[model samples]
Target: MANRWIRPEVYPLFAAVGVVVGICGMQLVRNICINPDVRVSKEKRSSAVLENSAEGERYAEHALRKFVRNKKPQIMPSVNTFFSDSNRD
Candidate 1:
């Protein structure tokens, strides 16, 4: 009777596939936007991959790394430390 329908049990499989596809799409788009030689605009098109490490690093540096470079490394205080420290002040 069903011409085109997925079983309900298969929904999770489809969801996982969708998530992987989305992640792959984001990576492709990010590469296109960030890569030096992969120019999108016609006026400033590049012929080959640029061998500029400095430029690549500028794009590749993680935001968290930059934020933590001048600060401490702890991302969050432990729950025990938070409760104990709270009582002191």
Candidate 2:
């Protein structure tokens, strides 16, 4: 008699599934980050460009403050929270 539960063929199937999932995740990240227009509206893009042209640092600081103020009270945390916490830790 031999053990029947540990199938040798299962390893390859799991590996293939993992690769597929990784590829899909990479595609999603690429789409989101590499293409800002996908997520940004026209008004937002115009404002960002205007802000970046004349006083870039000041604009960035103001934008950051506004973003933090708007999102701090929301139920879900913003992406900056993750970045800020990671840098501090």
Candidate 3:
């Protein structure tokens, strides 16, 4: 009689467990490695730049308005002649 190490049915279960464990471990490592100090510094800088200066706020607003205006589609009239003398008094 030959000794079999792994049953065929258990192989898929092991693979599934391995995949779940790997994903969990990767997420744990990423959470641990992320720098909170860098995030805080970036947030402070952004808020300071955006909220501190009136000129900067004006520039940002102007830029945003310009961007929105530029993104709008231009509507051209399909009719060639503007003046249609149909009901002239």
Candidate 4:
């Protein structure tokens, strides 16, 4: 009586049908959720530097020069010199 529910011979067929149905359902859901109309377009923005006048440019340049002068130069050791004792010095 327990075996009468789904015949053993038809098990593979049912599995195949279930797989196909699941794939189709997933595709349908994806299409519905990921439609082009559902996406929001981002607006293009302009930079403050682009909108500045001549006087603003001079002030910005002066600030940048001061910043550059205050920052210490970074020395990175060469990778090839890592193994050689003489090259490291």
Error of 1 at 35 (Å): 1.8
Worst 10 residues of 1 by lDDT: 71-80
Off by over 4 Å in 2: 1-6, 40-89
Q: Between prediction 2 and prediction 4, which has the larger TM-score?
A: 2
Candidate 3 per-residue lDDT over residues 1-89, each given as its tens digit: 22375778788999999999999998677545542222245455454333335644553466458776755353543342344445544
lDDT-sorted candidate list, best first:
1, 2, 4, 3
The regions of model 1 sitting more than 4 angstroms off are 1-4, 46-53, 64-89
Compare the candidates by TM-score and give the number of the best one: 1
lDDT winner: 1
Across 1-89, the per-residue lDDT of candidate 1 in tens digits comes to 55357778888999999999999999899889886657888765644556778977887686867877886556665765687695777
lDDT for model 3 comes to 0.56
- Over all chains combined, what TM-score does candidate 3 have? 0.35
Per-residue CA lDDT of model 2 for 6-37, tens digit only, reads: 57867788899999999999878866664433
What digit string (tens of lDDT, one per residue) describes model 4 on residues 32-67? 554333323333123213343664556446655977
Report the Cα lDDT for residue 53, model 3: 57
RMSD of 1: 5.5
Please report the TM-score between candidate 1 and the true structure. 0.54
Least well predicted 10-residue stretch by lDDT in candidate 3: 31-40
